[model samples]
Target chain A: MESSQNQFSEWLNKQIHSSNSGAFALSPELRATSLSVLDAGVFPNRKNEEWRYTPLREILSQSPVLADKTQINPALIAAFKEAVPNALHLVFVDGEFSNEFSGSISALDKTGLTIEHISTLHGESRKRAEDTIRQSSLSDDNIFQHISLGLSRSGLFIEIQKNHEVDRIVHILHLSTKSESRNFSNPVHVVRVSENSHMQLLEQYASIDAGKALSVPAVYIEVADGAGLDHFKIGLESNQSDHVSNTVVQVASSGVYKSHQYLLGSRLTRANLEVIFSGAGAQASLRGIYLGNADQHLDIRTFMDHAFPHCSSDQHFRGIMNDQSRGVFNGMVLVRRDAQKTDALQSNKNLLLSREARVDTKPQLEIYADDVKCAHGATVGELDKDALFYLQSRGIEKAEAKLMLTRAFAAEITQEIEIETLRSYVQDRISNLLDGVHASNV
Target chain B: MLSIKNLQVSVEDKPILRGLNLEVNPGEIHAIMGPNGSGKSTLAHVLAGREGYRIDGGSAYYKGINLLELAPEIRAREGMFLAFQYPIEIPGVNNTSFLKKALNEIRKHRGEEELDAIDFLDLIKKQMKLVEMKEDLLKRPVNQGFSGGEKKRNEILQMAVLNPLLAILDETDSGLDIDALRIVAGGVNKLRTKDNAFVVITHYQRLLDYIVPDFVHVLSNGQIIKSGNKDLALELEERGYDWLLDKAETRD
Candidate 1:
């Protein structure tokens, strides 16, 4: 494991010194920001609540090598072709952007939106994201501000201009292929939504037979005042993968930020969805659904920070754990001092379909504003026996009845997605998770 | 026909129905009149194969088959019905849908084809009319938000739809007005046939007045002490259970 870590670090250090790493145009500060994060260190085994559930120790012990930055694997390209046919299809293999496979993104080639890799962007194209990440920080210790600040990967950066309405979804597909041996992979992203801009970003993650793929991906969202952004992600990594994806969304004055995540793969997966409502009347809705089946273990933790007055956010997350799989949902809603009229609600409900399956749920609400309304609720229970019997009495077999109730419970989260195409896609994927039944069957 | 030969029912190791015996032949409405604590409801439950009640002695044979060997649902499917004194309130389940499921299960058990959605709706509408219940009531959850009289009428509606071979009415008249009783009794009377029987377990003879019974047996101390024809019910009603108490003591 030490040798693997040393090998991975050595490879990353070489990439930093490589001149082609700066082959594309970049601001001096931007180039430094990319190299500084990698130079900092590999994430420790356990420190933040975000890294709690995933099996990172085993990933670190496997001696993962740095992902090859110069090439794209045919297997990963093939998988993305089948999984996301309608997507604009931006492919990133082993933490490196691939121009050969994703040069002209179909979704980003249209008007009203500007999409480019962080390495290719120059001047205002790159400065805007860094400035938003800097100006949106309410504190010096903000996790996303530092993580995104440290993010060095040359990944997708989407900019939806002020007041521009983008009807098409911008899909970011990150695929990893660690050829011949165990490897460590890290990917980072930054997205900026201009004032009053409306757009949806769909992120998909997958890996194929890439031994010990360690994906520590970070996506940062900057929503300007009065702008609305929808961020949706689907994490379906190969079975031998360890994924740690963190999303940091900051909302400006009266801005609306909505996010939905679905976790169906990764041997051990943990996702942190944090929304900082920094401006007055800014609304943030954090809703997502997760499915854990077989021996897979999935953990989803969410944090909503209400740092401004008159800001409202509501979060509802549900998890379905079957077989011997385990799931965890920890949601915290924090209302800071002076953030009055901050109405935020957080709830997490999980269903453990089998006795062997387990779910640990926690909902915490911390309110410093006396006049604010904040509430949190968490419920962990099994399927209602009477409800099941009632359905069975209607001639629906046990499996079918359980599926119906599970779908109904999960449907609440999917319905909250304003993007119909993404919503339907998630619904179909969830149905397929049960028994490959398409969402249209419902 | 339904026959209870020296049946003993116990709950929590205390015997409630001690060697009680009664018989109901086809084309008969045998009203089992009893005072409180006389195990009147026990007989109804025992006949329906409700759980937690143990049969310590004897046996209950319904249509030549041991009724105790069957589950509650199987017994229900085999044309044996027990109208609960306090019907369970199943929320989130539509009343019409519940009745349709029960009706279809019973029909399938009898080797009859199940009814479709349209036919089931028509079936429920016709049965609902038998008890003079409003059509809207059928749309609500089973027994949820139903008044006492309405709940009882709905039970009778279920009986009419299921068309059981033996119908045991446990305090069916306990919570009903005269009009409601007349409608429920009229529905019961309309379904009476030589191939079917009714075991009306009541606290008072008032219910027997609407659907006049062929025989009346007084249930006291878990056993029948006196038996007579329809005249006995009116006589008992006129003189009250006090008269039967004296007659029971004299017979002892």
Candidate 2:
């Protein structure tokens, strides 16, 4: 494990030393921060409790060269425009902003909302962006967050002003182009919702070709008093890609935050989410679904901290593993002593569709307050025999019966999606994956 | 329409149905009444081809085809319906959608065209009235959160829609009040035809007062100890099973 860390450090040093002048012309603060974190040797190994189930040896064995700015293909841009026509699109190619591919948001500038590239910010906006980065970086102890913060050149910065309601959904699209060698990308995004405001955001990660690639993205969000935000993150990378993302959210007094994540593709994927309630009457809901097949490995880790009284939170996640794939889910809810009247619930359910498929789930609730109501449950099993028999007895074939039961199990999570188009799109993807699982079994 | 000869069934190597025999032709309704653990439900499950039941001996034939050789779904497709004693609650499966799929599958097997959405809705509406089921129940999950009477009525509603040639009512009146029993029995009477038959299994003679079975059989220790007309049910109601058991023991 130590040798693996040394190998990754050597690779990072080589990439930084051999970079061209254009790459070095970016912010020196980010580069210096990334280097110091690398030199500290804080990369996680099997010994770490949080990373025990997920080994990064396979990801680090082959050095991934840092992907530079690349031209966005016209066809890819056209396809994205068609995929989400109603959304305000902000496109990123190889972790850098692509101006020609992004949609114009000038009409939104006069409505007390600001959406700009973080590197192009001046004065107060730049200071706010730096403060957000510093605050989010101070709380995370993982190497992935440090890498994303230090290496990301330019990313999106969105702020919804106080008392304003944003009707249009802001979509951030991260598209990876084809490369001969393994390519690595780091992208960061910051979102701030002011008092009494409402906003919706969708973040999508995708790749064009089946080349080896790695993506590390960091997100920082803050919901002010009496504000509400609905956020969704979708991961649909190519089969040979590896993705790791970290999201940190803070909710203030009487605020509401809801997040939905759909992880459907990639050879190896990890999504770490942390949320904190800083004031009374705040609430949050986190829901996700992940599907894995063949040699894929999918992991989701969440931490919910209730530091104020009269706060509530709920977390529900489901996973489906087929063939020799594996999945892991770990959720922890912590209620401090001062956080009386705190109500939290967590549930993680998984289905193993094949004999070799495996899943590990842990749902933990640590309460230091005597007046809190907390509950957690975890279940890992195959389809219910009684349910399958009931369907078959109604004249449905065995294969079709199994498919219907699987779809119903997944619907419990997908039904929570509020956006109609996104919900249907996810259902169609899940239906296709189920069809593949049926075919492989046959 | 159905014939069983010396049927012997066991669950978990414990004998539950020992050499039970029965016969029923089309256009006949037969009632089998017995005490608890008398294997009345076991006989129904065996006919429906439920697993975990070992047939030590005997044979059952439906329209001259081996009933024991078919799977549960095959039996269902072949116009055999078993109204479960306790309907299984399936969450997330809409009631209407389940009924539509079931009816379409049976129709396809019988060389009939499938019903479209409009036709399915119309058929279910009419059948719902027959069983006195509410329209909102169709939009909810199949039997999930349903009351006891509602589950039984839902079973009868399914029977009205599928219109199977042989319908076996397994204690459908067990957990129902008199009003519910009347409604359910009325639903069965409406669906009865000369080409179809029924075998109603019950523990009380109360259900017979409404459905009016042509023949009544008293089952004891997995065997039919007595067979008579509707009057026999009244006799048992007056004298109870102990008297019948003593008479049978002396005769043996």
Error of 2 at A87 (Å): 1.5
Deviating ranges (above 4 Å) for candidate 2 = A2-7, A16-34, A67-84, A106-108, A137-140, B247-252
Most lDDT-accurate candidate: 2
RMSD of each predicted structure:
6.8, 2.4
Candidate 1 per-residue lDDT, tens place, B161-209, comes to 8888888889999988899999999999999988999988888888888
TM-score for each of the candidates: 0.70, 0.94
Cα lDDT tens digits for candidate 2, A1-442: 4575566667766655555534431256655777687667567877888888887877776677667667655886666444356888898776767778887744138666788776666678767766766666323368888777666665777898999998878889888778876677777788999999999999988887654578888888989999999998888888888988899998999999999988988888989999988799999999998899898899999999898999999999999999999999988899999999999999999999999999989888889999998999999999887777767666777787788788878887888887788787778888899999977885
Top-TM-score candidate index: 2
Residues B1-252, model 2: lDDT tens digits: 899999999999999888888999999999999889989999998998888899999999998999999977888899899898989888667789988988898889889999999999999998899989989999988898899999999999998998988999999999999999999999999999999999999999899999999999988888898999999999989988999899878987
Ten residues in sequence with the least summed lDDT for candidate 2 chain A: A18-27
TM-score: model 2 vs. ground truth: 0.94
